[model samples]
Target: MSRRWSLRGKEIAVDDEDVVPAGLPERLFATDRFPCERINMYSTIDFLLCVRDALNGTEEMAMLLRSCFGTLFRFPVRRVLMGKVIHGMLTRQVLTKKKYELWPVFGGNPFRFSLVEFGEVTGLPCDEFEEGYSIDYELPATEENYAYWERLIGPDRDATIADLVAMVLGDTGMPASRKLRLCLIIIVDGVLVPTSQIQKPSLKHVNLVKNIKNFLAFQWGRESFAWAIRTMKPCPKKLRQKTLRILGFPLALQLVAFELIPHMQG
Candidate 1:
């Protein structure tokens, strides 16, 4: 028997023969170092909390973040379980050609983690963009782009995640617009679509945020979800004996676990 599954607007047939056993024992044995290191959202959440406190008695905070990142602003920061999230990553099985679905065994039962589940859990945008719409394409790389980059990172070097955090927390003298831009940078780089090299922030993201309105309207959920799936793609042979670094927002996975598993809600 075959079942029809819809993922990210595409439909496919999943046959019983095609549903392979997780075969996790063999994969786990092949890799001695399955320690998963993922980018945490704590710093971003903390910064937002601080911003909230600072904007008490005013609607500026809402005006700044609500329109663009309403879902993220409402994210249950305290409920994230890193241990459970890492366990899910370690046992994840890539079961589809689209690579957007993961089936991870927990307590001897498999749970589905797919784009649809991720969007539902995190409230992130998951609709496929219309043709010719690109999320990663930044404004033209000109003097204007460099000027914004310089303002954020300075003229001498690329800005690291540490640098962005420092700006978000310490750079109080900056104008509200600049400060909002900086916060967006940190949130996107530090929490949403981070790479293993957590220090080096992407200039593409910086340039994209140059126009705040466009940045806010862009479908970040789709981009972030795609990055997470790409990072989670299994490559046991190449990753043997080395730490596995997970990219994208792992907090979503933790939240999903909390919802699906009763005991984990605590």
Candidate 2:
């Protein structure tokens, strides 16, 4: 049996055979000094800084490219696929309902752009689900369609999205959570449409991953802080202050805590 990481209560086997030198994963995530513990904070800040510097002409495209490579270092390709499926559904479902109107919300805004990106996420045409729903056989599957679909679906879509959304929402069966977050992130950040969307092998997939990583990291920190500030009702009088002081409060962390604690309490 291989060592594995348990994600959303599922055991995913680790392919690498290298033996850990005892307590590595725990130490990496648990310790303050270990890079993984604070990697999100610094990496997120650095990712933003790189973009800023690029826009300011202080950093050239070559330098930004190098930074981008480093920023994505060790990012789980599987997670990206999961996110793609979650967003893909939101896009396809809404588009099917109304070709011109973006569902979950109607606006010519950044959130709306995310729905448009659904096509890129699944590597299927925006009309796939609609065609399926209508039982239309007008669209033929080309070699490119098969290839892209293979890449997008990988092992599965619905199953993977189910797990990923559960992790993000702390819900047993909340289908709307991931889509809601994607819309909120786009609206809050007001991300511009990438020029690469027009090119072959569109950048929508690439940027989608980056956007999700940033949004999750930021939310994690935010929620952590909110958890600290909000007092627990019916707490022990003797330990109330101490409990508040020790909370790992950050804004991102608060959002995560809000999502998780309800499930935990239940």
Candidate 3:
């Protein structure tokens, strides 16, 4: 009689005399879900399996990626979609980390998974994206497509827009609230866009300059950018850098949405 425990969400067992139904593969052991929960353990593959299971029976991932990404839209499609996707993917993993740090915003390479994978899977026309990092891609407008998208995205677009902005900002060095404000500015100030230009990109839609700017003004007061800056506090160097890459680099996206040429000086 030996006490057994599960490991890494996998249904295997540990400790002395941990045998299964006696006739199974000698290499495998059995641990029931109740016991596993009692011991608090799981396998990495088990975790992935769970994710796979959750995503079963539908192509939501592909559809969301395609809808939010693909051709440029008048709203920030990638921004919104990326947040939801990352939130779904990372919340579980984040809970598992023994040592976790929660900043006002979450910033790191972890949030970039969907974008990186999307491009690889779609075989999209990313010609303009080759020369720069994730933040430098652009989204060109198409009037007919834009109108179709507007009708398709519908009224909830604003809520979705806010989510993406928050996620990206959180993934950056800025505070969650500030990330919201700053992202809004970048959207309207003509800094953010969804283009294939980034070495790896997350956003698949673009924002309108007037809409973004006006959104910023309403969201952040007259000194919105400056006010958002005030909220910045110190984080560890490693975390800070990660945040900047996730949040700051995407500032290049603003240029695309606005259709501005980066090299030209006013």
lDDT by residue (tens digit), candidate 3, 29-121: 112211111110010111212222333333532332243122222233334323222222222222111121111112221111112222232
User: Relative to the unseen true structure, what is the C-alpha lDDT of residue 74 in candidate 3, on a scale of 0 to 100?
Assistant: 29
- Per-candidate Cα RMSD to the true structure, in Å, reads 5.3, 24.1, 21.4
Ranking according to TM-score, highest score first: 1, 3, 2
Number of clashing residue pairs in every model?
0, 22, 24
The local distance difference test score of each candidate is 0.62, 0.26, 0.26
Alpha carbon lDDT at 206, candidate 2: 21
Candidate 3 off by > 4 Å? 1-55, 58-128, 131-134, 138-145, 161-203, 206-266
Best by TM-score: 1
lDDT score for residue 243 of model 1:
48
Residue 168 in model 3: shift from native, Å?
22
Per-residue lDDT of 61-102 in model 2, one digit per residue for the tens? 233234322222222222232222222222222221223222
Can you tell me which runs of candidate 1 are displaced by over 4 Å?
A: 1-60, 92-98, 130-144, 238-240
Q: Which 10 residues in a row give candidate 2 its minimum summed lDDT?
A: 34-43
